[model samples]
Target: MEIEVVVPGGATIGEAPTWVAAEAALYWIDIKRPALYRLDPATGAQRSWPMPSDIGAFALTADPPGAVVALRTGLFRLDFASDKLDRLAPPPFDPKLFRFNEGACDINGRFWIGVMFDPLTEASPPLKSSMHSFTLAGGLRPEPDAAELHNGMAWSADNEIFYLSHSQRQAIFAYEFDPAAGRLGAPRLFASVPKDDGLPDGAAIDDLGGYWCALHGGGRLRRYKPSGAVDCDIALPVSQPTMCAFGGADLEDLYVTSASDQLMPEQRRREPLAGALLKLRPGVSGLARSYLVR
Candidate 1:
């Protein structure tokens, strides 16, 4: 596949690529830079909103016509037009020790977010990160399991399984999901990466139950079958690919976000494309992501 550099300048920690079908634009965030960006693939037009604090992830909301943003401070609703932010919920953990990281909305429109210990801000041993589900009425509900660093978050094409990755542990887990009830069963080992290989960072699910995962620091994107077997592996130019999402008129174009943070000056010199937004045709369509409820 031919990899295209859609956005040349690298983001500090580029992540959470989400496709908005209605606008035909791709939305993403730069965590370290703390900004939200919208890119028009066809016209190469772009717009950005400066965030108040480190932004981990965001999901579009139909009713408010903006987004539910996950920031280091807490969760808030951002009105796209007014550029105003309204508090949705406070950070569950101490903001100094932990911060929100990866997140997305489920099929029922509930937002599922993960919290991770901020190594950049704290030097102590990392605390176990937790996952939470949020709704307009029910608010944030914490899940039982915890990981050192939570990253990948996606649902199977059928919505019968939930996929989550523990980047520090180099593992991706699968859980039986009940879309009607918004409940998760005990997690099973879905996939794991070797220590030499890159940790699984963020992921997207194709229509055929294939999970496309970006191997941060590995310089590759790997696709796995629903049965936990490797399907396809595509090499990437950047060594720190943080996330991938499917976009385009047919949803076959794969957009990847990479990170330029935490690299030494020499390393940065070696990786010119380290933080660029990349695109390629993966030859498979992806499922539409659900918008945040409320």
Candidate 2:
């Protein structure tokens, strides 16, 4: 339950931490810098690839043999070796008005991403954001929800439930998911985190059906029981813990990403570890991630 800095990275806003077990590496994105970063835990080696535009999130594909990145303009398959980016599909909304925020793969290998208003510093207009579903074959499809600042993206152990967080709303929702049909039922109010605890951000589901979510700007990570009761809350050094994923060979190590963006000069001086990659052992194994099959 003790979290420590594993990588002293200075990402403007590090989000979308994904554990690529096949490569034995953790991948995350810096939203403002518009870059993709990789860190090898064993060797303490790190590298980065500059993105063509602001990349909010991405998915690792097995079929296409590269990263499926969600940029401000559209989704593309990025080839680092050749510096080639092939457009997979355009965003459902105009890039100037909205951008992808956080995403993850579903049980059936479909990529689910949430859109948010551009320039998150100001209040956003209603109906400007949405959740989109994509597949390598079908391209992009929009869901029924309109979210302002969508962040957390996670699925249940049985693949029967879907969890997503609305940061502005300070709430997380649960949907009856049909993996076979790739459909989501009406969302049910799952949990509304306390305001002082910080807004709900990235999340991960455990084998015990517990939901572990990072509290952005709260300097804490919390685990919610199945009944929506608080089970655990661990303090973190960074105030803006963006996202987290279970990594390591056994999938027990929880790797978290933080941000240094939007901090006051005095605040930055007080928290020097604001944008570092964090590692911790939660003593519970994570549910296997749904990989992109197409």
Candidate 3:
């Protein structure tokens, strides 16, 4: 399916584009610039929230219910109706060790927020990160292992497995998941992508159980089946395709978000379209909307 660049917002580092079905809108975050954006595909109306720090990623929560955001420090639930934010978990016990990264919600509607070594410090260099998960009732739980640059969070259609990408290694890993217990098993390689384009950053699952991944450096979006096979590739004009999701009324439209934070001066000039939101009508459709746990 062909993808098109729609919202030319020119985000510095756009990641985690998610569809809020009930609102008929797409939500995403610009990490480096630290902003939250809400976009209406139908009307092209965009609203934004200025954040104090770079927001790693976010998901909808249940319980007292709101949007859960992964900040560089810790996890917080945002009361959208009241425009308030409350910390759910303190930053990693070892503040110097890790910071929040990319993540998404599980099929059960619980928010999963991962972490990586802090990139701002000399010891916490890029790509040296780890992944984690958070549940409203259970709190935060660390994954067995982590990555240098963790990203591209997702879950399978059946919710039996979870998928995440390591930008530093240029690999996507699939973990056997237990939805009822909210546990992850040993991870198996889902895909091995080339580093020249970029590592996988964010992803989404389709009804077919295949994963659509954003190649952060690859300047493209790729589809991989549960068997770890490449299904198709949708190349983009930009270099840093950070994340993507299936949106629109029918869930057949593919929306991609990109970034320009790491581009050199000359490269940035050449790829001015980097960091814009793009869209396309892929023939394949997505699954039913997964509401944010309230």
TM-score of each: 0.97, 0.95, 0.90
Per-residue lDDT tens digits for candidate 1, residues 91-192, read 888788888888988988888888778855647887896788888788889987687788889998788999999888889999999999899898999998
Measured with C-alpha atoms, the lDDT of residue 229 in candidate 1 is: 97
Winner on TM-score between 1 and 2 is 1
Per-residue accuracy of model 2 over 163-191 as CA lDDT, tens digit each: 88888889999988998878889889889
> TM-score of model 3 relative to the true fold?
0.90
Q: Where does model 2 exceed 4 Å of error?
A: 120-127
**What clash pairs does model 1 have?**
10-275
Clashing pairs in 2: none
The TM-score ranking, best first, is 1, 2, 3
lDDT of 3 by residue, 1-294 (tens): 455667884788888788877788898888879877888877779888777777888886545545788887677788766768888887753555566777776667666666666646576235444466666767877767666667777777778877877767788888899988778888998888876766777888788887888877777788887688899888888888878788888898888888888689899889978889999876678765454642
| Superior by lDDT: candidate 1 or candidate 3 | 1
- Give lDDT: candidate 1, residue 84: 95
State model 2's lDDT: 0.85
